[model samples]
Target: MTNSRGGKRERLASAAARVLHEQGVEKTTLADIARAADVPVGNVYYYFKTKDQLVEAAIDAQDSDLRTMIEALEAMPDPRERLKTMVGGWVDQRDLAARYGCPTGTLAAELDKRADGLDERIGAVIRTFLDWMERQFKEMGRDDARELAVALLAAYQGISVLTNALRDPELMVMEGRRLTAWLDTL
Candidate 1:
């Protein structure tokens, strides 16, 4: 039901996103999501039959947010500026990244061991960014655009790991600046 908080379904999806980002798939329960969303735990079953369905809702929410951000980033005509700005955006999330690590990276790492196709579902979140970064590199006339894309994400995820391990948001900012400079050379 819609109220001052918006649709319950939407709130649940948002809660799933936040909880999943902070807590990982295995650690996060439907009850946890329901509580975070301020909905009755039983009501969750009315909207999503299973936890996987709820996780999928969270993935959908991430995809939608990513699309909106990507769309805005695409408005920049220059590919290099687009990428640099993207790094700056990551820098903006230094605190969160430092605290929880890269949300997509952590999710992928946790889901990777699972037998179900959820791994690939969460993986597409990274792949989506990879594809966009690849396009940007391609526009820069790089012969190995895909390779650069992989390298870029790899560096970001690596930095995120270090950021969390060291409990230093400044590390991400430092790496973000370095990545932006590296992008300039590409």
Candidate 2:
């Protein structure tokens, strides 16, 4: 692909994500994404065969970023500290969640509307991260690694949801610590 083509594709994905974040998946359209990305409508089709494809690409990009972050958790020596750091990191990016509405959750919700295999693809990315975190917990001798992983992910998701709804960063941190402490037992 040409440089222009690659650039256009990036713009399209960015715009698609913006559209999904702003208007939600149900209301977002190719034209809206094109406008949001500041690319010509034709450029969108050039990169994406369909709107679902565009959404999938955008979601994949976001999930890849999340996986990268989760991978870093392995570097932290303490599992308890690692868990807290992970949630703290989420709190640190409160601005991103406040602005973009939690890309993981948003994409997951959007994927539910499409039957083009997006859910499994996105789910795989999520599971990859969750599995990594669970491994950390299991290595620390936490027998309920699976359940702890589920709870950890759920807590972060809940924090994102509540942070977005309440616009309180402290609430997220406070509740995250509370939940993190609770999860350490499991």
Candidate 3:
């Protein structure tokens, strides 16, 4: 029963992610998520005590997939190739932002007015992701991989914003390849 409940919550969380990504955090309500998930409005409360909790869960759901990707990178012993593979996945999949507009950025931009620790949670997730990326860079002989990781992350975030605004998925892959090419030169 616990596992089943957890599955239901996951389904709810995924539905919340879709709603939040499509409508932005401010516009996403429990009702919206409930409708999207095909679950009752009260069911949302059962899974998530508050809107913030729902948002956090949704963000967590998005990162769950990302964490898998990070693990995949860790499996690749070579840093450069790992970084390439990881970033390449994002660049190659242009609809990422269209489906979910950079969860970190979306959370950061929305949670600006939220309670104090809310932003911290988002920050922590992003930091973990960047740190993982930097680890790969460090393995590639770039002692200052942290800085490079930050730059690469920024580029990806900026690309997501631009792609979402312009509805151009191709630019993501183009810029990703361009960024990787530049990294190769370095």
Q: For this target, which candidate reaches the highest lDDT against the unseen true structure?
A: 1
**Model 3 lDDT tens row, 1-186:** 999789889888898877887788888889999888888888778888898888888878767877988887778767778877877887766786756667668777788777667777777788888888787778777888889999989998999888877788887878888987977876
Ranking by TM-score: 1, 3, 2
For model 3, what is the error of residue 155's alpha carbon versus the real structure, in angstroms, after optimal superposition? Answer: 1.0
Model 2 off-target regions past 4 Å? 96-100, 180-186
**Clash list (residue pairs), candidate 1:** none
Stretches of candidate 3 exceeding 4 Å from the true structure: 98-100
Instruction: Summarize candidate 2's per-residue lDDT along 70-134 as a digit string, tens digits.
Output: 66876777777777787777778777676665777867766767767888777787787788778
lDDT value, candidate 2, whole model: 0.77
Off by over 4 Å in 1: 1-6
Q: Provide the global lDDT of candidate 1 against the true structure.
A: 0.90
Identify the candidate with maximal TM-score.
1
Per-residue lDDT of 28-134 in model 1, one digit per residue for the tens? Answer: 99999999999999999988999999988998888888889999999999999999998999999999988899877887888789869888898888789899999
